[model samples]
Target: MDRPTRWTRATVYPDMWVDPADDPRNSDGVSPDGELPTLVDYLGRYRATLLMKCDDLDAEQLARRSVPPSTLSLLGLVRHLAEVERDWRGWITPGAVPPRLYGSADGDFEGAAPDPSLVARAFADLAREQAATDTALAAHPDPGERLGADGIAVRELQVHRIEEYARHCGHADLLRECIDGRVGQ
Candidate 1:
């Protein structure tokens, strides 16, 4: 038996890279397609990119904090994003509580390390949080509807989520590169 290749095997061809104008799904939707009309689509696509960036990495690789003085890793990002989704839900939909997936606010980034179990838990929590956020968003389809204690519009919040994921995804790029010389979208 042979050990599998690590991050070096994850590859992206030139055509597969995400284009700025194109929707993240990599395909035009329908004839005269209306485009992704909601924040969910945009943010969800960004989240997919983040996950794609980490695909095939082992727990040690995922949890490797390549950047010094910063506790940022792909695993940490997954945990952080899960908490972020829950926080946003709390802001917009008061009295409708979802159990906090990652425990404390800073715990996501704090406790993460190069451990397989912790890394697996991070990914699991991310998936659960994403599902919950989708459910909450579906309950109110109209993006124009004002939600959250700050009266933040759902659309704007969704865009913010996209921005958040996009930024962290960039971080993941650098971290992944540092960890194993892998690069690109």
Candidate 2:
């Protein structure tokens, strides 16, 4: 028996919102040129992609779960990434710090709700953590430099963050498409 082939509407717009040649986001402007710059660029792109997925959505839409028995939502993704950014920052620059952003539990996802305030706070926290992480890395240019008590390499931390953002961005794509008919690659 011939199995049914699967096709996705996600690629219906092969250009992905705009012609590749005219897309400003893909433009390699006067941005820095180096390994660090490349890694940061990819990570930043994924971060922006996630936010784009959450665009045009109200708190309720964002907080709506895609399927039952799962806590996953656009808002939850934002909160979880905020927590992840903070954790990665701590790994690279652990020191006298303030209290936890949302306590030690799974507050990130657990607290994600259909509240406008929570949505705003999650975005703010994500931006703050990402900036701090960049500043910390800039102060220590050596990617191979061991950091914190564990002596983890800066490269490992940076790579991990990129991977984290990439993974979540994929999830965001699915969640957004489910919320609306909008789809992309």
The TM-score leader among the candidates is: 2
Candidate 1, residues 73-160, lDDT tens digits: the string is 8888888998898887887787866666766767888777888888777788788778877788777767778887688876787788
Q: Which stretches of candidate 1 lie over 4 Å from their true place?
A: 1-24, 28-38, 96-100
lDDT of each: 0.74, 0.76
Worst 10-residue lDDT window for candidate 2 reads: 1-10
1-185 per-residue lDDT for model 2 (tens digits): 33223323333355374445544357656766887777778788888778877878899988988677788898988888877777776775668544568875577777788999989998899889788778888887777889987898878887898998888888887787677655664
Best by lDDT: 2
Q: What is the lDDT of residue 166 in candidate 1?
A: 92
| TM-scores, one per candidate | 0.80, 0.84
Candidate 2 steric clashes: 0
Q: What are the root-mean-square deviations of the candidates from the true structure over C-alphas?
A: 5.3, 4.8
Candidate 1: the clashing residue pairs are 92-148
